[model samples]
Target: MLASFDIGALGHSFWALTISGLTYGSIYALVAVGYTLVYGVLRLINFAHSEIFMLGMFGQYAALMMFGFAPQGDAYDMGVAQTLMYLGLAMIGGMVVSGAAAVGLERVAYRPLRRRGAPALVFLITAIGASFVLQEFVHFVLPKLTNNTLGGLNAQQPIRLVSPSTQFTIFGATVTNVDIAIVVSALALAFATDRFINGTKFGRGIRSVAQDPVTATLMGVSRERVIMLTFLIGGVLAGAAALLYTLRVPNGIIYNGGFILGIKAFCAAVLGGIGNLRGALLGGLLLGVMEMYGQTVFGNEWRDVVAFVVLVLVLMFRPTGILGESLGRARA
Candidate 1:
């Protein structure tokens, strides 16, 4: 087992792995933000959040289909201008669907429990059950709803929007347009989210509720409103991540596609500090980079193992995570 490990691969492809890792890390960071945000406000794990991500994938694909772009083996050859327009539209479509679904999930699955003063364990179980319900809906119901055009047992044929082309080289690693786009878009969204959370009045409300729900309620902060906003924001970001993810892996939009990725994102949230926004970002990038390195050294098959092991080791040493800060304690 020791001899099978190839440490030299990391030395040879350090830059390559780093760039690739950052690209994936960006996606993970976006999805992990949702996990962190929901946990911060509700202290709920939101296991069904991954299913929301999956729906966003399908939502964006449907948007493309509505635009007359059929699923095919190759990407559309439209000019950069048209491609950007369609991509923007697709992103919007995903965001809307995901945002609405998130709100609905809160209303249908969680709000009733909240009214009943359900235990934390009940909420967690509901989240898991909701996740299965969403997945199965897509697996069985979506096909019938869409006349078999959208979701089923297999991955939808890829509808590529931007074909990757090498744009530059860093050290010895090549960077593509897709890599640049994913990283830049993710950073922009994250920055915007941070600013909104820290600077806006609504954001203050969220923080207040998170820090002390009873006090925040006494201060006239509507807990329900804050919770809804949290879910919306998280869902929108997940939708954006879904688009970026599809750009990187076009054929990844299956009914159960979000399962592993969602788990990784949750691990990222825990790794960084579950309720901390900045921590989620940091944890995701670190997880992505480390996972890439582990895959390189151990083999592709070890990728998932590497991610889980990192989570376990982190939990063993620092249960509160790397940052060990809660969202309520975050500085403005």
Candidate 2:
């Protein structure tokens, strides 16, 4: 039961849940955009995106371990410069590693089947199988291969990279230290992505390839390269999501926790309309607000149920989702 429903704790918990849901939904949107991006061009859901996210988390953990995650109490006096440097390295390492793994998954798993003209249903099966394989990969193979079981995974004091004890209030919502970090970080990423897709030459190449691969190739666009970069960007986004999510929850054991979020995120993407970035963001933000508001009205225990309930209702009314574009077409 959420203390929010009780008058004594109402404001704090309500606002906490509200901001928490927004942060989660934003992270989910990042993962969902991956699914939508791949689906946009290939018309296939890259269910392995969850694995990409999982690996991203693990990748950062690995780097953190290498750099020595700060000790508990006297982690004091850690310079902002050092902290930022470590965070930057972890993020870059996570993104690059995850992006590489994503591409590898594409080339190794799907590309051959696609070449053989595998049916969409078969591809669906492959996606599921890929997911399970990835789960197993993280659970057993990665440990065995590296000969190092990740310690302190569920430790009480999970690492916090950038913690500014600055709180703010807005629209009856209380924002916390991590809340600001998550929101600002996500906004920055989103803004940069907008600029990249709208301003850069490579972005146009991606758009061209996405709209029509054959036509793009005829017009001197490298379909292969664009597809590769699409996955790269997808992986990068998943990595970004990993940092935000890891900081929020802080104590997940298995790497594939991204699976749950990925499912919800993919749902969000479809709810808004797959292949539409703006739609993905809109659906994610709306879904977040709905989830938090639902928790506020009911109890936090019903958050997931509430979210899906709203989604079901929305789908019942607009079966093609809010933006009304089905499958590959970008929705308005």
- All candidates' lDDT scores? 0.93, 0.74
Which residue segments of model 2 deviate by more than 4 Å? 1-13, 70-77, 151-157, 163-166, 171-173, 324-332
Candidate 1 local lDDT, 83-156, one digit each (tens): 99999999998898888889999999999999999999999999999999999999999999999999999999
Residue runs of model 1 more than 4 Å from their true location after superposition: 1-3, 330-332
Clash pairs, candidate 2, are none
Q: List, in order, the clash count of every candidate structure.
A: 0, 0
The deviation in Å at residue 274 for candidate 1 is: 0.6
The true-versus-predicted C-alpha distance at residue 181 of model 1, in Å, is 0.5
lDDT of 2 at 184: 74
lDDT of 2 at 66: 81
lDDT of 2 at 37: 77
